[model samples]
Structures are given as structure tokens and as C-alpha cells.
Target: MLETPYVAVDVDVLDRNLAGMAAVARERGLGLRPHAKTHKCLEIARRQVEHGATGLTVATVSEAEVFAGGGFDDLFIAYPIWPSPGRAERLRALAGRVALRVGVDSAESAEALSAAVGPLDVLVEIDSGHHRSGVRPADAVRVAEAAERAGHRVRGIFTFPGHGYAPGQQHTAALDEAAALSAADLGDGVRSGGSTPTAPLAEGGALTEIRPGVYVFGDAQQVELGGCGWDDVALTVVATVVSRTGNRVIVDAGSKVLGADRLAWATGFGRLPEHPDARIVALSEHHATIEFPAEPPARGDVLRIAPNHVCATVNLADELVVVRGGAEADRWRVAARGANT
Candidate 1:
């Protein structure tokens, strides 16, 4: 057995998740360019490519570099990043190395990125519902036109159904995303939108592509939002119970290992799959306080914790311990971990 406080990926579950998403994309006639910001593992990315991903979507330039170094030829930086001088240099390098695409939510971002990385492909970001980034669907043409003026190739518009990660909101969020993209007249460009919760409903009419990241490792947020069941959770943190007091116990895995990204809808910081009623009440840098049922596991017992946010949790780990046949099978490095530019 590998040491506790380590991140583990159930190979069977991971493969099932990948196949499930790929099947949906194939059936919908939608392009599958899964976000690499979730697993950040070359092994997982390769598996996704084998399962029919057309390209990889990443959040940062460094992540693109890591995956590009791993031989992934096509990449999309799916964030409206304001390129600094250093980031501009890196983006220029990445542009030369791969089929690079990026998101542009404003004319300023479009112009800046175009000047930094000449002739790169740009996707106008439309604010479907999340109100995070992205221009309004009605204003997508302005951003696309600006990108064109900057001498960049406009690949069309995309939206993220970020609001879909809530109870009974996936369908509505997906519809909103579709409506936004339909309203944006991009003219034969790639209209993309989808989150893990809304991907199952993605269709061909409005979107030509779907870029979801957390499907490979369903998290507590996905579970509560009904995106996936506990059984679908592929990645978890393996922690050893160190101290116990009645129904509450301390585990070796904490915020540093499991990530501290509990959503408002989440019951706790994380979930204990074996003890469904248990809640991770608190987390220190290296310790997790879990409150379980009457019959709590004893000290020194190893437990698997499904985190609230799999993407952030994966970014915290250096490697993932692959589990097979209920045992550790291999160690896969999180090669893109800390690759935040």
C-alpha cells in the first residue's frame, strides 16, 4: 500500500467516466476537447485522447506548455487571460509549438492577446448565465470583430455553464448556454459550451464543441448537484485516521491534500464514501476533522475522501496513486501541477 494522505485514482472508475463522456460527445456529434485543468496528468490526457478527445482545454500557459511537452499538439487556453510580458513570451512560444486557441471576452483582451501572440486563434467568450467572464451574447460579434481587426483568426464563441453546478440547474443552465450561442452570430465558427453537470444534455444545434473538465473525477459538488453519483467518483484522497473522540476523528489529509473549495451547497469540506453520513467538519493544513456516524472507524484505519472540488484538489497533488483490484497499481505524476502562470 502506498502512504496515506495521497491522492488516488480508481482506474476502473476513471475509464468508465472517460468512456461515458466520450460516448455522449460522439452521439451528439459534438467535438470533445476535455479541459486538462482537472486531472493535469499526461496519463489521463492520453486516455482522454484515446477515448476520442479532439484537443485539450487548459486554463494557464504553463499548463499548455506541460501538456505540449507531453506531445499534445492541439490546445485551448479556455480563459480570458491578460497576457503580461512573460506570459506573452510563453504564449508566443506555445503558438509556434501547437495548434493553440484562446478565449477573448473583450476587445481589449482580444487586441492585447493578438499583439502578444500574432495570428493565433481566438474564441469569443459569451456570458451565458454565470456572469463570471465573457461578453454578452449580443456583444460577441464586437469581440470577434475586434479579434479579426487584431489579425487573429476568430474560431467562434463559447460559454461555460458554471451556474449548472447546483441542484436542478443543469438543464436550465444548458439551455441558457445554447440560447446565448444561438444568439451570437459567429458565422461557421466553433460554438462551444458545457460543464460536467450540463454535458449530458449537449446537442448539435447550438454547440459544435463541449469542454468539460471534472467529469473524470466527480467531486462532492457534482454529487450534491446530481451530476454523478458517489459511485462515479474516480479520484479520492487516501487518508489515515490518526485520532478519534467519539464520532469525530482526525485524518492525515486536510486542505493541502484534499483542497479547500467547499461550495455553498456542499454538506462539508469533503465526503466519506464509506460513511455516507459523515462530514468533514474542519480542515487544517495537514489535518481533517471528520464527524461520522455512531460506529466510526478506529484510529490508523485508512479512509478515502471524495473532495468538494476535484479540479482544485488535483492541482494540489504531485502525483496520483492509481488503484486497481483494490490495490495500488501505479503512480502517475501530476505533471501540470503548479503550472499556473
Candidate 2:
């Protein structure tokens, strides 16, 4: 009974999600290297390892440092990190401690990383459809060659397949990954690709590993995108209705806690589990405007809000109250919260 407006993790739901993703990986014969950026908690990371995850994927050096310090030996910094000046020594130090894998999408980045940390495992990031930091699939080979010339080991190619978040896009994203890998012409490299929405659609024949982050904690966006359902969301922001107006109710949980990640196709800022028709219309730093299609929530009423994105929401909290069997069991600190840099 710590009070409302706090983050809560449903243990049972979390376990189900973990098992489901693990089963998918096993069935497809793909290694599960779940992204640690979703939770950023050491305890959750350990649980992922227990669930048969081959290793962990992180986004930044700071996150890799946190996980490595917490005894996660195998880690992949999945972001394209430009190793320059002081960062070179830190990269070298990190590589020495754990089996570190870095991503390189360009020849310059590959050369810089290779020069910084000599003879380390590297993955060429192909832009399947996200059009983000990754290089074109046709250019992956050039980047790999550059990394090799710089003395780094090119192990494989990977893509995010982020376009799968849209409707009827998972199959196309997977095909893009295949096409890109084929164009890369890198033989024997681990073909890694996947996001939560696209993981189930992935054939796994070309992919040696699947890195799906949000599967650990389904969110409102997942439900809307058809990646998951309402019961599948494992984490929620438990808030208390503080005020009521005509057709509108205000909750204590706001953008600072719930995050502001409204996708174009999302219903609202977030979704209410108990009242599916109700919508989190607006989110300020301290107030959330909830619109009720049927009825307004009264003051002191407790509410659970499923966020649009779990990873960003988790980053905003300092700790999470883990609930099991409808009872609060434990509190876990958000160990790597704000480890963005």
C-alpha cells in the first residue's frame, strides 16, 4: 500500500510473456538476446537469463556497463556508437570485461570503432525499413569490410524491422530483412532481426537470433498494433483520480511517469484497463486528463493505465512495485533509469 500514481509490475503476466517469447525463440531455433533497455533493471535482466536468453542487448555504453557490472557476461551494444577520443578507452575497457558486441552501420563508424577497440566482434546494422541509423542492406558488406580492415571481427548483420509496428507490415519487414541480408553478401554472419510486433511473423530460417525488447512488458501500443492484447500487458501505472469534471477525470500520473509516446494510430496517451472506453486524452507533468466515454471516475478512485510504450515509461520511474496474485510482493529499483547517454 505505498499509494497510487506508482509503477506496478504484474508478476504472473510478466512470467507468461517471458515464457511465450522464450518458447518462440526455442521453436524457431533462434537465440534470444532480449534488449535490456526495456526494463533496465538488473533483477529483470537476471530473470531473462533464467528464461533461456543467450545474452542481453543494450542501447548504450552506460547500460552495458550496468549489466556487465551486474554479472551479465555477454552483451551487445545494439546502437551505432561512434567511438572517439575518451570513448575509445572506455570501449576498450568494456570489451575487456565482457564479451561485448558493437554495431557499425557506416565505414567511418566501423573504422573508428575498429581503431578504438581492435579485433572485437561487430554487427553490421541494415536499414530494413526503419530508415534510422542503419546502413542500406546493399552497403552492409562495405561496412563489414571496413570493420575487418580496421581489425574488428564482422560476425553478422542485424535489422530492427521497426516498420512492423504498423498494420499488416510484419511480413513485409521480415522480407526486407531477407532482401537486405542477401544483398549484404556476408556469408556465415549471424542474421539477427526482430521487434515484438514482428517476432511471431519471423521465419527464423535466416535469423540466428531474435532481439525483441517490449515482449517482457506489453503495452497499450502493442494491443492496438495487434502485437499483444489487454491481458498481455504486464506493467501499468496505478494512479488515483484526483478531480472530476463533465466527461473528464484527472489522474495524478502524468507524462513524467507514464511517458509521452503517442503513436499516430494509438487511441490516446494511454489506455485504462478497467474502463477500456476511457482514454488518457492529455498528459502534463503532474496531471493526466482522462476522458470517459461512459462515466467519469470519482475522486480517490484507483486506476491502472497501460502505457503506449513500456520502455520509455520504465525509464521515467525510480522503482516498480511488483505484484503477484493481486498482492504487492516486492519493490525493485529501476537500476539503469536515465542511462540514456
Candidate 3:
């Protein structure tokens, strides 16, 4: 038996999620390159490859290095990276070791990246309604031309429909993504766009790939947004109730493990799959205040918490307790846990 306040992944649920995503990608004739920033585990990454993922998408150079070092050959650093000296050296080394691709949105970073990594494959990022790290769709060709002028091979354009996370926004965000990709005149190449919320609806004449990461481990946010059902949740934080008063039960899980990301639409800090009516009303460094529908459970009762965001939750974990038949089956290291650069 393992200790409380630990993260556990149901192998059966995970396999089903993997197979479902692979089937979706295959049916759409889109390349599945699930983002590794979700699980950040070599075991899960290997499973994604085995399940038909053409490659993996990472957020940072360190993350790319970790997975590439762990034997994943094709990696796409999806973020617009302005390389520091150390990051440049690492990117150069990674380029020599794997099929490395990076994103660029400006000429300055493109020129600097070329100087640092020496003619690497590049993708110009197009803004798909998230308005985060990408240029306007009309500016995609401009960025691609700049990267090409900097001696980098411009592969294609990509976007992230981050706005899809909200309720009733997925279909619109997907439409925006498709429109953006259609407007980004980058010739014929990989036009990638996707998020777990928008993946099912991601369709454009120009789309050739999708990079959704969170489908492997359903979370509270996904559940609330109707992206996945409670039974589809594969990962949960197993916490023990330490105190109970009236209708409130305080658990051992906190922001340190569950992450501090609460979307505006989220009902609470987290949720209890076992107690569907209970809500984690608040969280401190090491405690969660749950509001129960009725009389609270007695102290020492175990609760499985689905965090509002699984990516941040996985990043906080050191290992994922693989559960099978309601028992611990194995432990998988979060190999890329601290790979933030």
C-alpha cells in the first residue's frame, strides 16, 4: 500500500484514452503529435509513440532535451524560443541528436536561432484566438519568410486554440484555428492546431497535424467543460481526510501538488470523483477545504481528487503510481519534472 496524498494513474483508463485519441487522429488523417508537456514521463511518451504519435511536442528546450535523451527522436519545441547562450548550446546538441523543430514569430528570434542552432527546421506560429505567443495569421508568411532569410528551413505554420478551455468556446475556437491556418499562406506543410477541448472539432482544409497533450489524463477542468467524463479520468490525487467539521472536510492535497490554476468557470480548486457532490472549496500550501453535500466523511477517509489542471499537477509530481485492479501496479518517474528552462 502507498501513502496518502499521492498521484495515481489508472492504467486501464490511460490505455483507453490513448487508443481513443489515436483513432480520432487516424480517422481525420491528421498526424498525432501529442504534447509531452502533459505527462512528462518517458513511459507515457513511449506509449504515445507506440499508439501512433508521429512525434512529441514540448514547451521548452530542457523538456526537449529530457525526452530526446530518454530516446524520443522527433521533438517540436512549440514555444517561441529566444535562446540564451546555454539554451543555444543545448538546442544545437539536441539538433544533432534528434529531428528538432522550433517555433518562431519574429525575425530577431529567427536570426538568433539560426546563429545558435545553424539552419534548423522552423514553424511560424499563428495566433488562433488565444492571443498568446503567436503572430497574426496574415503575418505568418512574413515570419516564415524572415526565418527562411535567416537560413532556417520554414516547415509550416501552427496555432494553439487556448481559448477552447472555456465553456461553449471550443467550437468557436476550433473555427478560429481553422480560419487562421487557412489564412496563413505558408505553402504546403504541417498546419498544426489542437487542444484537448478543440481536438474533436479541429478541422480545416489546411490542418495536417494536432498537438493535444491533456487527453491522456483527464482532469477537473476537462470534466466541467464536457471534454471527458468522470469515468474517463485516468489520474487523480489520492488524499486522506485529516480533519472534519460539520459539512466540511479538510484533505491533505493542496496547491503544492494540485497546482494553483483555477479557471474562471471551474467550480472549485479541485473535485472528488468518489464524492461527485463535494467540491474542494479552497486550498492552502498543504491542505484542501472540501465542502460536502451532506455530513462530511470521518477523518482518515481517503478521497481521490481530480485537479483543475492535469499538466501542472503532473509537473508537480515526482512519480505516478500506476494502479491496476484498485492496487498499485508500478511507479513511473516524472522524468521531465523539473525540465523548465
- Estimate, for each residue in 1-96, the C-alpha lDDT of model 3 and write its tens digit: 688889999999999999999999999989999999999999999999999999999999999989988999999999999988999899999999
Tell me the lDDT of model 3 at 209. Answer: 94
- TM per candidate comes to 0.98, 0.97, 0.99
| Candidate with better lDDT, 2 vs 3 | 3
Best TM-score among the predictions, by candidate number: 3
The prediction achieving the highest lDDT against the true structure is: 3
Residues 225-300, candidate 2: write the lDDT tens digits.
8778889999999999999999999999999999999888888999988788988888998799999887797899
TM-score rank order: 3, 1, 2
Error of 3 at 123 (Å): 0.3
lDDT of 1 at 212: 91
Query: How far out, in Å, is residue 62 in model 1?
Result: 0.7
What value does the lDDT take at residue 182 in candidate 3? 93
Q: Which segments of model 2 are wrong by more than 4 Å? A: none
Per-candidate Cα lDDT values, in order, are 0.91, 0.88, 0.93
CA shift of 143, model 1, Å: 1.2
What is the number of backbone collisions in each predicted candidate, taken in the order shown?
0, 0, 0
Q: Please report how far candidate 2 places residue 30 from its true position, in Å.
A: 0.7
